[model samples]
Target: MKKVSLFVKAMGLGLLASASAFAQYNPKASYEGPAKMNTWSVSIHGGPTQFFGDLREYDFYPVGNTNSDSYSERGTWFVGAAVGKQLSHLFGLQLGANLGNLAGMKRRQYFSYFRSNYQQVDLTGSVNLKSLLFGPNKMKHWKIDGYTGIGVLRFKSTAYQLGSGRVQRFTKHNAGDGTVTPAGYEADWVIPIGAAIHYEISPRFDIGLDFRINHVNTERLDATIGGDNSSVYDQVGSRGSFDNTLARKGSSSLDKYGYGSFMVTYKLGKNAIRVKKENGKYEYDTTKGTYHLRWTDPRNLIKPPVILTLEQIDSVAKANRPKDIDPRLLLDSDNDGVSDYFDRQPNTPAGSIVSGAGEAIDFDKYVSAALPGIACAEIFANVQFDTDKNIIKPQYYEMLNKVVELLNKTQCRLQLSGHADRRASDRYNIALSRRRVEAVRNYLVKAGLNDANRIVIDAFGSFKPIGDTSRNGLQKNRRVELRLVP
Candidate 1:
C-alpha cells in the first residue's frame, strides 16, 4: 500500500509539473451556446502484469525460477486497446479489451505453480479529477482521470507439481460430497478500477501512463484451492480436485491481478493547429477548426462580465468628454484675421485690412475717407438665434431694424454671415446656417431698406466657432454676425 501511494503521488507531480509550463488564453465572455469540439478517440497500451491469488508467494516481487524441476513464471505481459468518447470536460466513457497471462508460484506453502492465459472486456466511465478540483482554466494540457467499471474474464489454467512437472488433476471433492471433475476453462466477473495521467501533445494526440487492478469473482484463478495449505508434501497427491465445488469449499478471497501500462491516444475530428500569439493568446477559428473536448471547457472560452467602479466610470466619462474649443478658434474679439492669442494689435478696426501680425495698415488713409474707392469701417450688432432654430429672435428685431436704417441712410451695404453651434452634423449645420443668413437678409429688406440687393449673405457652419463649444457655452455660437461692407 505504501508503494502504491508513492506511485500515485509521483504521477500527480508529473501531471502538475508539465501543466505548469503552459497557459491557455480565455476569450471574451458572452452568453453563447457551447461550441462543437472533438470528442472521440482511440487508445492502445501494453505493460507488465502480475497475479495475486492462492498460488502467489509475494505481494509485489515475483518468484522467477525457471528450472526444469521447479519451473515458475511469476510475471507476464498484457496488451489492451480502447475506444473512448468524452461527453464533457469532466466525464467520459471507454470500451476496452485486454489479453494477458497471469503466473504465481509458492515453494514454501504448497510447492505448486500455475499460469493462466486470459482475456477480458469492459466498459468504464472516467472522471477528470483535475477539472473537478480546479475549474477548467487550470491545467491547460494535462488530465488526471479515475475510472472504474465491470467486465467479464475468461481464462484457461493448468497447475503442476513442482518436481514431477505433471499436471495436477482433481479426483476427490474436499467436502466429500461427490467426485470432482477438472474444468479446463473458467469464466467470472471482474471489476477494474484505476487511474491515469495523460498529457496532450497536440490537438490530435495524447500520451499517458495508467495502472489498473482487476478483482475477479472467484478464487480458483490460479487453478488452486485454499485447502492445500498443509506443509506435508504428500497432501497434493491425496486430494486433487480443481472443480468449482472443491474450489468453493476452501475459498477465502477473490483473485486479483494488476498491470501498469504506457498509453498512446489518437483523437478523431477536424482539428487545426493551435497557434498562440505573442500576447499569450490563442488564435482560433470556429468556422474552420474545432477545439478538442478532452482539453477544452466551454466556460473557459467565455469572457467574464465587465464591472466598473464608480470612480472608473467617472474617469472614463471625463476622458471622452469634448474639450472646450481652442481659444484661437473661438475668440477673435476684434474680428481681425489674427486670433487674440497671437494678435499684438487686438483692437484693430473691424473693416480695416490688417497685416498678418494684426497691426493696422494705412490707418490714416482710412479714417478721413481720403483715399479714392476706400470704403468706411463697417458696423452692426450681431443677431442671435435659438438652439437649432433658424428663426430670427424677437430680441434681435430692434438690432436688425437699426442695421436697416443705417443701410438706407448711408452708402454702407449689409453683409450677413450666419453660424451655428457644433452640436449637429456638419452638413445639417451648414444648411441651418444658410437658412439663418437668409432670414436676416429677408428681415433687413422687409424693415424698409430701400434696396434689397444692398444685402449679401454668407453662411459659416460649425467650422468657425467664436465661443466655447461646451454645453453651457454653445449658445454664443448660434448667431449671425452683421457687418456693413463695400
Candidate 2:
C-alpha cells in the first residue's frame, strides 16, 4: 500500500510538471496564443477482452481442448469510460475505468479452466503522435495518441473441473510459498499500455478505436500456477512439491489481458475550427471562437513574417511616391498666365496686365472699346500667398480692386485658380488653396463688384506647382492666378 501511494504521488508530480511546461509555452503572436484553447473532454468505449495466462490453450482460437469439458473461450466483452484533459498539443492526461470478464482453458498439460470478472481504474498520459510528427494543420481532422499508465485491478476467479463440476481449492499447504491468495476475490496492481486513432467528425465529438493490454501483478489471476507438471499430478493445484519437477522457475509467468475497443469522445469548451480561405490559407476562430488544445500546436498557429528584398522595397516606394511637378506649370519667368514654353514675350513687366500670349495689354483702351461692344482683352496676374496662409496680402488688394472695377464696368468674368506649396498633404493643401480663393472672391464682392457669379474658381493643391518646392519657389507656388475673360 505504501509503495502504491508513493507511485501515485510520483505520477501526480509528473503530470503537474508537464502541465506547467505546456502552460509556459507562450507563442509570440497573440492570435495564436493557447490561452483560449478547449482542454477538457470525455469518452466512452466498449470492446472484447482477451485473457492470456497459464490456462490458455491456443493463441487466438480454443482448438485442442474443445472435445474435453475443460474447454472454455478465452475472450470476453468489456465496457469503459474516461475523462481527459489536454495540457498541450503534444501531451494530455486521462482517467479511465473498465469492467470486463476474462476466461481461458487448457487441456494438454492440465485439464483446468478459470473464469474471472474484473474492474480496473487507470490514470494515463497520452502523447499526440500525429501533431508531434506532422504539423497541427496537416491532418486537421485526425488524431493518433499513444498512452501508458498504472492502475489497480480487483477481480474474483472460480476454478472448476472439466466433467465433475467440482470446484478446485488451493490452501496455504498445497499452493506452495503461500503466494496465491485464498479462493475468493483479490486486488492487485496493473499497468496498461496502448494507442488510439481518432477521427474528429465535428467540433463537439470524435470517434476512434483503442487497443490496450493490461499486465496484472499477480500470478494467481487464473487460479492455476504456470508450468505445473501434468504427468506427476492428476489434478490441478494437487501437490505442494510440484515446483521441483516443473520445467520453468516458480510462478515465472504473470497474468495479462487485452481490450480492443471502439470509443467516442466528446470535447468540452469552445473549440474553434479552422477556416480555409480561397488563397489556400487557414484562419482560426472565424467560424468558432476558440481552438481546441488537442489539435492546435502553438508554434504552427503563428503566421510567418513577410520578407521583402531591397529591390522590392524600393519598387514599392517608387510606386507610391508623389509624381514630380510638371515643368510647364513652372518656368514662367514673368508673372504672366503663359509658361515660358508657350510665352512669345518671356519677360513682361511685373504687375503688367498680360494677354494669353504673355504680351502686355492696354488696360484703359481695352476697357473703353469693350463698352462699345468691343471684346475685352484676356489679362492675367498672380496673387502671392505666404506659406500655409490663406489670407490675401494688402499689396495684392489694389490689383484685385482694379479687376473688380473692370468686372462691374464690362460684361467680363474672372477665373481664379488657387495653388499651395508642397509642405502638406495633397488633401490639406487643396483645402488651404480653396480657402485662399474664397478669401479673394469675398473681397471682390465686398468691393462692389457686380455679379459675384462672374467669378469662377479652381483649387489645385501641390500637384500643380508654378515653381520648384525650394525656399525661393515656395512662395511663388503658393499663389492664385487670376485670368479675366471677355
**How high is the CA lDDT of each candidate model?**
0.70, 0.73
Q: List model 1 lDDT by residue over 169-255, tens digit each.
A: 422223345544354456777778799999988777899999988877667787766555453464554333543453432534667
Q: What is the TM-score of each candidate against the true structure?
A: 0.53, 0.54
User: What TM-score would you give candidate 1 relative to the actual structure?
Assistant: 0.53
Error of 2 at 216 (Å): 1.0
Q: Report the lDDT tens digits of candidate 2 across residue range 1-486.
A: 433564566467456546543554643422236246678899999998888887687777653344446654744789999999877677788999999888777666656677788889989888787876675768777899877778898787766666664666331212355554454466778878788999988777899999897877766677666664544344654622223322212344677789899999988886446334446765654334666777766665556788989999999999999989776556787757788877888888766778888888876565545563334567888888888888888987777777777887777788999999999999999999999899889999999987899889999988877666678678778888899888
Q: Between which residue pairs do clashes occur in model 1?
A: 28-303, 29-303, 170-240
